[model samples]
Target: MSLLSMTKTNLKALFHGPYTSQFPLKAREPFANTRGHIDCDLSTCIFCTLCDKKCPTGAISVTRSVKATDTTPEKKGTWSIEPLKCIQCGYCVETCNKNSLIMKGECSEPATENVR
Candidate 1:
């Protein structure tokens, strides 16, 4: 009786197709309010270092230029984030006064080395 039941179940599953989707070919949608990676908009950013200070894990780093001259009008500063160290807490995004920091819904890609 047990063997018959097992066979019936196996046959049903065989014709039913796979329960899971092909992950690589088709990715799942992100959940509602998913805390993903942080992104910075350099154009609007003032490099105020507020995001760096608010980061709990010290994932954000801001390097501001010493001085802005007329000749070097575009010399603002460098803003970078260590994706490996980020905890996706969203504090950095909230602390950004210029609204330069953005929390993207898509997750960060896999990386063997630390990405800036």
Candidate 2:
């Protein structure tokens, strides 16, 4: 577009206000099928390592460690998902048999930590 046309367009947009809502004041809801963020319930989770295996980006981490004091046959692990690398593909959710992993409507906000 020409400079004059661009200027006119910008002026119109400024006077009429933005077409979208101002962020932080009004946020749009996620779509019904949108895969936003992943959450895990540790108590319900069996630490099967299925989510870690299913994650395409390798964002999910499942670490299993045996405690000497605990005499459980099954080893337990902590689950963590790195938001920066996650693609929100919902692969982990589909793989989780225990229903401990869930995809929430709200995604992770912008962050400076571990940002590549």
Candidate 3:
């Protein structure tokens, strides 16, 4: 483009201000098939640890506790996910056999300075 055209375009952009909406007040709708956050339903979960194993970032942690007398370990314990580390890839949701994991449209909250 010529220098005159470039100058005109720059002036137009400067007068239009930002094209984006005010984020907090007017949130944009997520695109179709967009993966945002991962949520797990512990009730249907068998503690199979598939989600933990399939997660690329090691963001998921599945732990099962067993009693001293029990021969088989109970399908229950801690299931924690680090939102900051997760990539929102939906791999865990696909790997879950019980369909207990879901990819929600809402994204994870931004990490604060106090987060560990």
Predicted structure with the largest TM-score when compared to the true one = 1
Model 1 per-residue lDDT tens digits across residues 4-49: 7688889989999998998989998888788888899888888889
How are the candidates ranked when ordered by lDDT, highest leading?
1, 3, 2
lDDT of 3: 0.83
lDDT of each: 0.85, 0.83, 0.83
Sequence-dependent TM-score of model 1? 0.75
TM per prediction: 0.75, 0.70, 0.72
Q: Report the Cα lDDT for residue 45, model 3.
A: 78
User: Poorest 10 consecutive residues of model 3 by lDDT?
Assistant: 67-76
lDDT, candidate 2, 1-116, per-residue tens: 55586887788888996798887899888888778888998878877798998889999999776665643424466788888889988889899999999888887787678667
Candidate 1 collision pairs = none
Which wins on TM-score, candidate 2 or candidate 3?
Answer: 3
Error of 1 at 83 (Å): 0.8
lDDT of 2: 0.83
- Off-target runs (Cα >4 Å) in candidate 2 are 1-18, 67-75
Give a tens-digit lDDT track for model 3, residues 71-95.
3424356688998899998889989
Ranking according to TM-score, highest score first? 1, 3, 2
